[model samples]
Target chain A: MLFLIEDAINGILMGSIYGLTALGLTVIFGVLKVINFAHGSLLMVSMYAAYWTVALTGWHPYLALVIVAPAMFVFGYYLQDIVIKPIFKAEQDVREPITVIIVTTGVWYILDNLTLLLFGPQYRTLQDNPLRGRMLEIGQMLISVPKLWGFAAAVLTASGLYLFFQKTRLGRAVRATSLDRQAASLMGINQYKVYNIAFGIGTATAGIAAVTLVPFYNVFPTVGVLFDIKGFIIVVLGGLGSIGGALLGGIIIGLIESVGPQFMTATWTEAIVYGLFLLVLFVKPSGLFGVRYDW
Target chain B: MTRRHYNKMAAAIVLILAFGLPLVVRSATYLHILVLLYFYAYLTTSWNLVGGFAGVLPLGHAAFVGIGAYTSTILYLQYGISPWIGMLVGGVLASFVGVLIGLPTFKMRGAYFALATLAFAEGIRVMVENIDRLGPFVLNGPRGLQIPPLKLGLGNLVFASKEPYYYIILLMLLAVLALTWVIARSKLGYYLNAGGEEPDAAMALGVNVARSKLTAMAMSSFLTALAGAFYAQFTLYIHPKSVISLDLSFEIAFIALIGGRGSIAGPVLGALLLRPVSDFSRIYFGDTLPGLHLVIFGVVLILVMIFQPRGLQEPLTRAYNRLLDRLAPGQTKELGT
Candidate 1:
């Protein structure tokens, strides 16, 4: 029972980060209606950026986010401006989404391979970092400091995103565009600008998730492959564009991964998480917290 | 003369060249490349069955490849069965899996189907990776099964030379093309396209969307398994990474997409054109820069999707028709058109 409690705590912590990862993908899908297969690669880019910042100059990981998030937002904005806008300016259909999805897959390969070329395939871990390797114990239960901070950061940013969506004019426009692109444009929302900003925000979320991750995870090019698959599963479970659903789906998946190993073999935990994902997809197609889709 | 007669003559000449190429080119490396090309041609052609015709873009086709590779290898390793027979057995088994997977997946559309299929593929991969725990003697998990080398014979399907593999794969490609040719003109193809292009319209027109999709998936899986079995026998090795990874899935789908989707010549031409670039890049510069070929493929895939969404077939066909029009007025009615 005590072990189960620890698992639950760990699950929630990791799940929050998972939620952050899925949020990037969810926003892209919500705004552009295109699944950003390269979102994981963008996360990889953020981690590498943070790694270099810490390695080159003495700075906290959180301090590095100040540089990273804005840089990433600009990059994503350029991506939308350069490639996505010309294509996405027109309305999308079923087949068009598949084509756009494949384009993101191409983007993934480009970024991932370039990273492999630059950084090599070897893994890097943070050393002497403040968020590295310390734990707190309350009674018989122990909690890792890094994950705790990561979880806090995730919650803070997620709420920040929630408030932005609720209050800001740009955020409102993004929500309107997602609800109906034609109708939104008819209402004087410049979908071109909205798409660009939404993509930027989507990529900024990746930067946020990456900062939270560098404390514990090994940094590598192909590391994004794991998050890519997991993010896609989370997005699907959350019913595509649903924000709260992404969080709930991420938590559910994390819990399954954590608690599943207690009963099954440790290796099968990955499989169990995916299995549960498929189960949710088939059984509850609308998602657990089926709230407003884009908002 | 009619354009039909001209087309038949062109086909016969191409067939003659294919049969006679081994006589003129004796380089083993070139033959190896050619064999690889034909192999991919078969795989991609089969892939277009579901991807292009049925419009269910599966990103998890590697499941069939792994299953086919493992089934025949295991049968040969444990039961001493010839791969010729074992390939057919593997094909049947893969088709069974196809049915099992397709039933639920048919309910999904577009991206949902693609994601679900990918999940299914990953699920199978995880299972295959861990199955050795139950009985290591069978699945062998990660170590993978290796087919012992054997003497060359028609029955054995083992070759002392590369020519046999080349010819066999070419024949398989030709068979697939012929199959595609027949299906393209048949009611099934029309139904597939209709279902893919407009499901509501197809249903209103009395097409059974689920049944047609399942059949296409079954055919596709069977052909993919045959290709997989052939790969095992040709390489004399079977492993999860080579046979089952999503990379294999991407190549099959992307090659078809790059060449042309829903066109008979698209997949073969796509494989023929791009496979050489991939093979040559891997052979020459693979060590110099990791993933150079993949980078090229990714760029090409994006460019093709953005710029040439219909693939190379459109321009090539246009050029062909223009050429025919210049040669003889009003004599350019093509087969597929």
Candidate 2:
């Protein structure tokens, strides 16, 4: 019973991080209707940004988040405008999801290779501070302080986002555009501006997730690929465009990963998750929280 | 009738060139390159069936290849079975696994399908690395499985020189090419094309959308597995990292994309072009400028997607047709005027 409880706690913590990572992907998909395959690479880039800031300026890793997150936001806005917008604006039926996928995949390929070229594939750990070594003891089980902080940060960020989306005018405009771009445009919402804002916010979330995760996870070029897959799976499981679904899906997958290894080998954990994904997909083609669209 | 006659003549020329070229280029190195080209072309052609024709975009083909390689090598090492029989067993097992994966995930389109395939490949790689016990011949995990070159015989299919492997792979390539060509021209091909172009329209038109996609998946998996068997035999080694890595899957997909998808000749063209470039890069730049070739290749990929998404074959075909028009002016006029 104690073991199960510990697993559950770990799963929730892991799930919170997964949720945070997936928030940006889901948001982008919601507004732009494009799956950013490069989202993982962006996370990787942000993690490095945070890593370098801490190394050079002697700033606290958390403090570096303020800079890295906003920087990523601006970068993402421009990236979408330059690379993605042109593709979408092309004369052909270029807005097909497959075309978006190919474009993002190309971005992923370029960025991943760039990271390898720059960083040289060596795994770098954030410098050990008091926060790094500390752990919280509960009964016989120990929980790392970094993971605890990650969970708290995720909850706080998500709550802030929820409040902003509900209250702010820009958020409402973003939501309107997501629902119906043409209708939103008719109602005086600048679709391009909304896209820029949404892309910025989405990438910012990824940057924040990177900063939060860096304390525990080692930074590497390929590190994002694993997290990216997990994030995408969470987004799908939760239902596309459903933030709440993402949260729930992340927790479920986290628990599965945490407890699955106990029953079988850890190697089979991924297979188990994929197997479950297939099962869910077969049963609910629209995803756990996804609404069916005419398309 | 004239076109049919011309096609038959072209087919005859190709067959003669395929079988008889080995006699002229008896150099072991050239033959080795030919074998490699044939193997990759065959593999990529198989990949194009599902990824190109059906538009499923399986990013985990290397997993199927790994399955085929592991099955044959393990059987050969343990049960003392010849690879001739072992390869068949491997191909069947891989196809079965492919069916299992395809049945559930084929329901989803685009990114979801791609993600699922990637996850499957990673899962297999992890499993292969962690299997601790399998008797005296423990798969050396990350280091990979190494086997001795078997005696050359009809039953073994193992060769002392690259000459025999060249012919074997050539035949395999021709067979795969012929098979893909048939599929491309058949009703099933039409169904696949329709499903890929517009799934809802195809479904409305009485196409069994799911069945068509699954057929492509099964065929692709089978051919990939066969190629994997050949790869294992040729290299005399099979490692999880080498066979099941994401890099291998990416390479296969890259070849298909770079050559052109949805065309019978695309994979063959892609494999022939890119393999030599890669080999050349390895020889010249590997020591002094490691990873440079891959960096350039990545840049090329980006440029290709941005500029010519249809791949190198489209422009080449147009140019070739223009040249033909110029060379045979009277012939073109006879057909049109």
Candidate 3:
């Protein structure tokens, strides 16, 4: 019973972080109306950023978020403005431009291989950090301190995002553009600017997720590939564009990965997750928390 | 001669050169590269049936290739079956899986379909990696399966020389290209084109767009699996990572798109252009910069998409027609001079 409880707690905590990792993907999808295939590469870039920040400064891992997030925001903003915006302009009539997907995929291959060339394939982890391997214990239970911090970060980020989207002027402009780009344009909102901001926000969240992961995860050029697929599944399961749903979906997957090993091999859980994803896709193409109407 | 005759003559010349090149290029290294080039051309052509004609990007065609490679290898290793026969069995099995996947996925739109296919392929790869044994069969898990080169000949499908593999893949590419040409003019071809461009309109016109897409998927999967068996025989190895990989799937799509999807000659042109670039880059800079080729590929993909959304085939084809017009002014003179 205690083992199960321990696993569940770990699952929830880890799951929230997974949700955080996928947050940027959902945000980008919500506004761009296209699945950002380069989203994983962005995560990878941010993780490297976080890794270097903490390693070089000898600061707390979370403190690295201050620098990484803003930097990623700028990177994503220009990426959209310069590389992707042209494709959007060409396919303005298309609700979801397939060519943009290909372009993002191109970005993915470039970013990942560029990193490989620059940093080599060797995996790096932050050693001797303040939150390296700390454990929290309460009544025969032991939990990872980094994961707890990750959980707080996920909740805070999601809530903060929710509020920003709901209350702020820029947030409303983004929402309006997402609802109807042409109509928003007619209302004098620069839809292109909104797109840049949304992409920036999304990439910034990936940076935040990277900071949380740096304390616990290994940093590598291809590390994002691992989470990239997971982010896709989580976003789909939680419902694409649903902030809370991403969190819930991540918890579900986290639970499966954590508790599933009790009865089967660790790898089988991967199959189960895939199976569940397909089931959701067939049964509810809109996703668990997504609206029935197409975005 | 008429323009049609000129076109046929051109095709014949290309074919003859393709067949006779192996005679002149006796070096084993170049032969190996040529064989792999033909192999990619064959794989990309097969991928074009669904991805190009059906207008949906199925990024997981590697799943079918993996299925074919594994089926043939396992049958040959355990059951003592000839790989030639195993190849057919693999093709059939892949077709079934393809249809099964296409059923639910064909209902989805662009991004959803792409994601679903990617997940399905990843799931299959994960399953293959985990299962070392399934009842009587041994998958060897991540260790993969290796075929011993004991038997040799056309019948066995294991060759001692690279020329045999080159000729075989070349023949397969020609056959698939012919098949694509035929399909492009057929009723099924028209239906597929319609469905791809405008599914709702196609359905309204009684095109049975879903069924046509599924049919194309089945055919594409079968052809792709044949290449997988060919790959297993040529390399004498079968592994989850190499045979069933996202990179292979993406490469196929990249070739199709860059060469111009939905066109018969696009895959061949793409393979011709991309294979040499990737191969030579890897050979020259592999040690110094391991992933430089992929970076190049990404840059090329971006550049081509940005400049020529229709692919290189369009410009090349137009140039070819202009050349033909200049050469064969006699027909125009007879008609109007």
The candidate scoring highest on DockQ is 3
Give per-residue lDDT, candidate 3, residue B13. 97
lDDT by residue (tens digit), candidate 1, A1-295: 9989998888888887898888989888877777788899999998999889878888887788998899999999898788766566433554346677677888888899889878899999988887787788977887788888877877787788888888998789889987788799999998788988999999999998898899788999998988988998888777787777787778877888887789998778888877876776666645566543321
Error of 2 at B210 (Å): 2.0
CAPRI class assigned to model 3: medium
Which parts of model 2 have CA positions greater than 4 angstroms off? A1-4, A91-96, A138-141, A182-193, A261-264, A289-295, B1-34, B132-143, B287-291, B330-337
- Cα lDDT tens digits for candidate 2, B244-286: 9887887888788778888888778888788888777877767
lDDT at B285, model 3: 90
- Chain B TM-score of candidate number 3: 0.97
DockQ of each: 0.55, 0.38, 0.76
Candidate 1 Cα outliers beyond 4 Å, as residue runs: A89-96, A291-295, B133-137
TM-score of 1: 0.96
Winner on TM-score (2 vs 3): 3
lDDT of 2 by residue, A40-122 (tens): 88898889998898878888878989899999999889978877666665523433456556667667777776777677778
lDDT score at residue A169, model 2, on the 0-100 scale: 92
TM-score of 2: 0.90
**Pairs of colliding residues, candidate 3:** none
